[model samples]
Target: MHRCTLSKEKLAAQPGGEWTHSVSAGFLKTLGCLELLSVVGLILPAVLDIAPVMVPVTAVCWVLLLTGAMITRGRLGQVKLVAGDAAYFAIAVFVAYGRFVIEPFSS
Candidate 1:
């Protein structure tokens, strides 16, 4: 009987944090997916054989956006998730460099 009440309390306490994390992470994950597609589809094509400045500009914007996300998570005491945004920022920078300069010069 006592165990049942303890289990119930534990279950009740979980949704509050889990749901909040799920919602926030879900939002960021979806946006990250879009950004990924943009990097490959839009930025890469632009940098490879077309207008070049937009790709770097987009990369800068992406890094700034992720920084803002990290700041928000910090304000919410969710610093553990900041690593994901940091990775995204790094990938964006890498994509910018690889597409705009490295690939063009190597080939």
Candidate 2:
């Protein structure tokens, strides 16, 4: 939610939105939307028991998003910026695997 709010503020052309400065406003907004939706998917479907399959799928999507962010940060030579994304990627991967195999949500 923190990240999504910041990206949304960037859409308003506000200052201090450096987190998304590397990308265009439209791209940032789209990414924010995806992130927000994934957040919803992470919680709502499982809680509601409706299409609970979405939780792991959303985790996979987050893994992909974090992978892209890490690659982009690498290309920019921003080694320091890569850590967060890498950490997020690890967690997302774990969620994907755990949810799919160990404790998948039931419909």
Q: Which candidate comes out best when scored by TM-score? A: 2
How displaced is residue 17 in candidate 2, in Å? 6.9
Model 2: per-residue Cα lDDT over 1-107, one tens digit each: 44545554544454333446556766776787788898998889888888989999999999988888788778767676688778888889998999999997764
By summed lDDT, the worst window of 10 consecutive residues in model 1 runs over 1-10
TM-score between model 1 and native: 0.49
Error of 1 at 31 (Å): 8.0
Instruction: Give per-residue CA lDDT, model 1, range 10-84, as digits (tens).
Output: 433552223234344445456656566656654564657655556665776787777877776667676666777
> lDDT winner among the candidates?
2
Q: Which ten contiguous residues of candidate 2 have the minimum total lDDT?
A: 10-19
Instruction: Give the alpha-carbon lDDT of every model.
Output: 0.59, 0.77
